[model samples]
Target: MKTVLFPVLISSALVLTACGGDDSPSKAPAPEVISQPTVAVKVAAAEPVSALERGEQIYKRCKACHTVNEGGRNRVGPNLWDIVGRDAAAVEDFAYSQAMEESGVVWTEENLSTYLLKPSAFVPGGRMAFAGLRDEYDRDAVIAYLKAQSPAAQ
Candidate 1:
């Protein structure tokens, strides 16, 4: 019996030794992560609006008081037909301020630019209640619009 038990115990010990190491399951290695290169991006600039188109939009302010068409009736202000080259206060039957009537000036583009910048400063005691345009682009746009609307331009 002692001889048989000793052989059985030796065989069990050998079997346990063969199954050694950690009890947890074996795991595969994780995949390596690759980084991408950075890139530079450029944005395109927007197209600029034409002066005539911009002026037409700005002139909506004037539409309340004046008309730029031929034979268009005057409103709070006089009709502006041929206004770019016409004399100051030249609209017939439309009453003008004493300062404007006596200004004795032609409606040159430069003169118009100055006047539209500050109506009161251009002609003290004038009756135009419009606050002048501060932006040079706005003044230029409206001038282009008025010039384009003229019969002479056609």
Candidate 2:
């Protein structure tokens, strides 16, 4: 019995030592962090289309209702030959909404961007049925296209 007890105590002592029996609050070892590789991944930046080109794509949507030629006639909407600096509802012989006529908005690039984003919001009760161009880039492209074709541009 004594011999058996001696071996058991030795076994327990060895296990306790092996398993870190020290009750004194010992700080854990700090973890090692590996540094990243020096080589960086490269990406090809997309070539952006000229504003006129991009706006042409956007204007396709407007062409059904408006024309951009210098002496074009009005369709469902007014001809937009010199629309850039024109006052709202200023197109002669074209009917404009009361809200638009009274809104007093000049078609500056900034104003056009805002109006094209959401026309009804810009001019409530206006007759432009197209919901709006939601993309800022698209609005900018469209405005650029209009600028390129304005009477000044001609």
Q: Could you say which candidate leads in TM-score?
A: 1
How far does residue 96 in candidate 1 sit from its true spot (Å)? 0.6
Which residue runs does candidate 1 get wrong by more than 4 Å? 1-47
**Worst 10-residue lDDT window, candidate 1:** 21-30
Q: Per-candidate RMSD vs. true structure?
A: 14.0, 6.0
**TM-score list, all predictions:** 0.71, 0.69
* lDDT, candidate 1, 6-109, per-residue tens: 99999999987666656876463556888898898898988889999999889998999999898999999999877898899999879999999999889999
Local lDDT at 98 for model 1: 95
Candidate 1: residue 69 Cα off by (Å)? 0.7
Model 2, 1-154: lDDT tens per residue?
A: 9999999999999988766777887565666888988998799999978988999899999999999998899999999988888898888889988898899899988999999999889999988999999999899999989888876887
Worst 10 residues of 2 by lDDT: 22-31
